[model samples]
Target chain A: MRVSLSTLRILVLLGVFIATVLFFASQIDGYMNARLFNRISGSVAVIALIAVGQAFVVLTRNIDLSIGSVVGCTAYFTGGILMAWPDLPPVLVPVLAMAIGAAFGAFNGFLVARFRLPSIIVTLATLAIFRSILVQSSDGSSITTDRLPAWLTEFATMNAFTVGDLQVRWIVVISLLVVLTAHVFLTRFRAGRTFYAIGSNPDAAAFAGLNAARTIFLAFVISGALAGLAGFLFLSRFGNITVVAGLGLELKSVGAVVVGGVNIFGGSGNVLGVLIGAALIDLIDTSLVRWALVSEFWREAVLGLLILLAVAADTVLMRRLLRRKGGAA
Target chain B: MTWMRSWEGFLFLVLVLIYALNAWTSPVFLTVGNQINMVQLSVEKIIVALVMTFVIINGEIDLSVASVMGLAACAFGWMVQAGVPGGWAIVIALGIGLACGAFNALFIVGFGIPSLVVTLATMIAFRGFARVLVEDRGISGFPDWFNALGQRGLVGPVPLAIIMFAVLAVLAFLILQRTAFGRKVYFIGANRAVAEYSGLDVRSVKIRIFIASGTVSALAGIMFAARVGAIRGDIAQGFELDIITMVLLGGVSIFGGAGTMSGTILAILIVLALRNGMALQNITGHIQTGVLGVLLILSVMVPIIRETGSRLLARVR
Candidate 1:
């Protein structure tokens, strides 16, 4: 008599996506422009990069609150390196950035894996510590470039291709790649499904001898490394890095991960959902500015509302499914 | 008793040592005036940390405390400006805090979600609400009586707010040490289902801890307003992390089942002393934050290293 819970959850989210798109569509009387698209997509790319990495951690039922700091550390180091050697290749920056991030991520995983400490606490301690290092290292000065290598900024804009009078940025292309790769890794790869299995039931996964430590450690490394890649792009796009740069990102990325329907308790949710969640959050920011009727102070309120609505929807969906299954029983 | 069992005593010794060091190094540090100032500044956050001890000990977190404090401060100040009696305003202020914590608990308990993500969302969401409530501007001009909160002291230079915080801390220490509810809290935090099977009223205990945390935060909110006599959306900036650092450094396990208020108070003093010492030494604010970060990592590392060392000894023995 009613829609199944999983389907209903998707349908509700799709409905929200559609409704927001339509509402925004109504405002598309040429006011929607390239600069706006660039700004929104730019913001989405940074958050997506972190969220995708966080997705890996969350898949293992562990979380890394240090992603924002990882981004900061990597970006600052990237800036320092590139500024000293401006002529050095663009590809090299990403490589260094990823390595630094992976080292930290591996440390996180090691603490959880070797010491068997909780990921939340270990990451929490590192979050402040890393941010502190960034603050001290910079001494409040931003690491910036007067100009980036051409390829560095290429990800920000697409290949001048037109689709129905709208141009998607190259970052959008990257976003698709990131999301696709994430989806495949989670769904198809041996390591990917292992993450789901571990998160779903850690004890059983351990009993199955899946090397929970390696899987979790790798997840954190991927999360941290990807955060580094994101950091490189962040510097390239924003052209600035300071003490507060990438500040408050961990929470926002967590918000994105949580909103995307990845259970905080872990075990469920997909990257596709998170990608959509990321876009929706971006759209919300744009739409709020577009509406112009309400006070701008409502930004946090609306975000809180979205988180609540998602949790509420999740509860209702779960209850409905439980009721159906129990009734059959 | 095991060390963890008598952690309170060990913690008190550390507190004494810290105070002694402060007294020895800075001639002005132990002076009644400076001590009062230290107490006045740290009370609100200390109170919040006090209740947070219970929440975290119960295997939950309330990241919304800062936001609740922000919203409460905004509401309390705005109401007083609108001609609400200060006493009645205090009541409403506490109510707003309870409401905010309860709102967070709504999803936490109602949806069986982890408090971390829920509170983080609300941290943004509620801070956003506060921002909207008082759009980027701070409100001031409280009655002169409000200023009395910061200036007045009872019994030879102990600020009233500090005195009040001390009283609350002592009462909390007693309750946590001497009450069935306290034991139940530990039980539930250590293991929820077992406590439930023991008929310990886990839900009510949880809801009550949240209320206590909310009320403590609200009290701090008002006291902060009284102390500073100002209301702004951004008051207590980055305070949530600071309090958590104090709590964790105080030796409260994030996973719950262990921790003491005495340790929390000691940790707060260590942090306050560090901050005060850093400030007196002319360190910048950024550095102060960095020091706290350093302290957080070091305190965590020390115990870990201690355990590792002892374990190695045991194996060799």
Candidate 2:
């Protein structure tokens, strides 16, 4: 059987994930417990959402460095709104958050698509601008758990069902559904495939009658909306929102996207791989705290190392694979 | 000269208007002391910005520069605390910076990875290393002379940092505008394949530029440590924002192969003046950052807007 390159990448990634979990299980006492699964899965849900969003942007050969800021902004704003109106419908709150996030993402997309500016530079500016807006608006205040509605705060740990000491939370299920939906959309829909077409070759895509600019714009919008959704999840999970709430998550999401076998340069990858990547990263990050030998300060360094290694390994493996295929042809 | 009608010229006019406005608004804005103080505060970023101009112009970026600065500063602090001589500590800290740069170059050039991804990872890793070295503790109380080099004005009201900036600015201009190596940077950035076919050692040029960025960033880090008279794990964190802002605002193309050192210097002045003016008016740091972010976006957008407007006009004609 001949597996496609992306499928092979995902398979290799799954193998690595299992190997890593097994390695950690042996290294740490009681590492294979249900509590570990619950903690890691809950955290992975937040990161996985953002990583999926980042994958959309990266798919179109653009990036949204401002996603972290968008997450922070939406989370804080959503928290503020919920605190003001505790009786508001739960569905409306996430909609409002997604609306706010989409607005910010539209601004980024407009600048990049309309002006044909480099997405990296534009998003980099928006990143600071969005954070600064949060800082200015928040006025040195934070949204604490005490002010949040009980339902929202309790939703974080509310389990959907338990399977032999392992409890599956609602947020995890929502995240998984999102990943699967995005996966189907990207593979099965014509419009969704435009992202890959444009990313793989913008000129050729344009020549083939595709609206590259519009696709790029849509990618950012999706990224922003998803990030906003993640922000809502973030608020529910933590129940505390600060101006720095989503700081450093931009890098983390990018780490997940790249490590999940998505080409950083764009045109390849899937959300399912990103979900596994998020789980792998959060697993290491949470596990490192209990590993004893690695200090807390070393976590960010390990994340960086993992990204570099992932990129290097992808390049080497792909090259070897391509060469072998060329020889056969 | 046609240069007077270019973007830098327009920036010069804006600079003058800002200076006038600042002078009008604040009583002490025009004073030599205030002017020197303004430059003193951001001298390190501007210095690093000088090298960053080269990196951007060469079609690459070093996001790791700020983290490299943090690492160098923290390493120096740790070594001093470990009883290493201050002088030796400075040397070793700089060596660490060079190593960090070489590490970036190795992956970027050797492994064929994009500079953005490589530097992003290193940015985190380098800052991580800094945090590990200092571990939330503030290191201070350096030898008196070492502090004096950063704090005191060696040339009568002009501190050593200012003097260094001046010398480096001139050298950067001369090297960029007048040297064959400068030409190679532009050629490689403009079209790497063509440059290679034309027999330029594109790899060597890129490697050298990154190494220079690392070294300059380290020097800036050391200067930061000296000026603040303290060191911590988060030293120079987010400084890349301002440094890159300066370079990009100066009209350096993010895509590489175009820009001038003179534009960057003017941008440095404009940014420093803007920040200083805002501080004089008691604007908070975050709000000021917000303004710079706006400027950063506008700087990139305005030119494209102009070009498109002109094209539309031509079409109508």
Candidate number achieving the greatest lDDT relative to the actual structure: 2
Residue range A185-276, candidate 1, lDDT tens digits: 88898878998988989999989998888888899999999889888778777766777777777877777777788876678888877876
Candidate 1 lDDT over residue span B140-248, tens digit each: 8887877786667756767788778778888888887789888887888889888888777888888888878877888888888888888899877567777888887
Q: What is the alpha-carbon interface RMSD for each candidate?
A: 2.4, 0.9
lDDT of 2 by residue, A1-329 (tens): 89977888789889999999998888889889999989998989999999999999999998889999999999999999998999999879888989998998999999999889888888888999999999999999999999999989888899988999999999999889999999999999999899999998988999999998899888999889999999999999999898898999999999999999888888988888898899899988998889977777888889998999999988887789889999999
Best by TM-score: 2
Candidate whose DockQ is highest: 2
What is residue A128's positional error in candidate 1, in angstroms?
1.5
**Model 1 interface Cα RMSD in Å:** 2.4
Would you list the clashing residue pairs of candidate 2? Answer: none
Overlapping backbone residue pairs in candidate 1 total 2
